[model samples]
Target: MSLAAETREAVRARPFLRDALRAGLVNHSAAATWLAERAGLDGDSDAIAAALRRFREDLPAYETDPRAASVTMRSGVGVVDDASDGDGNRAGESLLLRVGDAAVVDGGDRTAILATGDVDVAALANALGRLAAADVDIAAAGVAGDALVCVVSRRDGANAVRVVEAALDAVPVDEN
Candidate 1:
């Protein structure tokens, strides 16, 4: 494969690098050197940097779109394993989410943060990132239709709500 192809593949393998390049936040020279060593690209740094610049030119500029949604926090949620028959069906316990054998059921020590309306996977992704940065542990998270649900400990409910709200306020959108 050509050096340009290898360089592009290297950048693609690391999502943050691509994002940084799109936002014009990457130092091309430094990135090229790092990619050469880490990605095993047998090429000159100058050539790799030039390839990166070309790749950047083709990438859409990074942008975010604020979502319109109502955020609500519901306490007393819990996760139960073996709550499903592995057929994507819940065991009828007021389930908020069910995947394989685990389910987020009502009435537990956890809290569920629900965002409905104008919400999608992207909104959920943003919320999850903020939640992680805030040192909040997530039990389960999912998005269906216009609704997004994130489960966390009861103690982190209030802070999770704020973090989720801020995250949804400016969700990163794909311009591709």
Candidate 2:
């Protein structure tokens, strides 16, 4: 049978295997072994082995598209100050800045362009500019702390990957 067909059959034979696969606990072979061990069955290794091979073959279909991946950064600083309360009690004040997810989408896909991280506004703008220069469509953008979040999209798959890569590269590396 074809790999897809074999995978479907394997899933049908053992529904719990789906959870195991999704959880990343084991591949098809280990899942089959687990099932066999639980059922106290022996000499069924061949069947399980075949099913695992088919599942492995079909894994590429479920893999994330590299072109769709994005990069993001989150960085920030904090400050504390001493203060006096109305009751004459000592108190402290705190301030913080956090950068959320920055991403690139095709038009308005909403998928992040990069993993989230803290980045500076200048670096973020430079990245955005680079993406725009490459003709990557930007849906939205925001800046938090030293980080910038940008959404970029492109009609071509290759272009999307290029844009995301360029934007990520524009982020400045910390020397300290």
Q: Each prediction's Cα lDDT score?
A: 0.91, 0.46
User: Candidate 1 lDDT, tens digit per residue, 58-155?
Assistant: 99999999999999999998999878656655545687887767788887999999999999888998899889999999999999988899999999
Model 2 alpha-carbon miss at residue 28, Å: 66
Give the top-scoring candidate (lDDT): 1
Report the CA-based lDDT of candidate 2 relative to the real structure.
Answer: 0.46
Query: Candidate 2, after superposition: displacement of residue 170 in Å?
Result: 4.4
Over 4 Å off, model 1: 85-92
Off by over 4 Å in 2: 1-110, 154-158, 170-176
Model 2 lDDT per residue over 1-176, tens place: 55445545656576345434433456656666765676444436667657665564453322221222245422221111222345433234222222232222222323334434544554556566676787766555566644345544323334544565665554433221
How close is every model to the real structure, measured as TM-score?
A: 0.90, 0.30
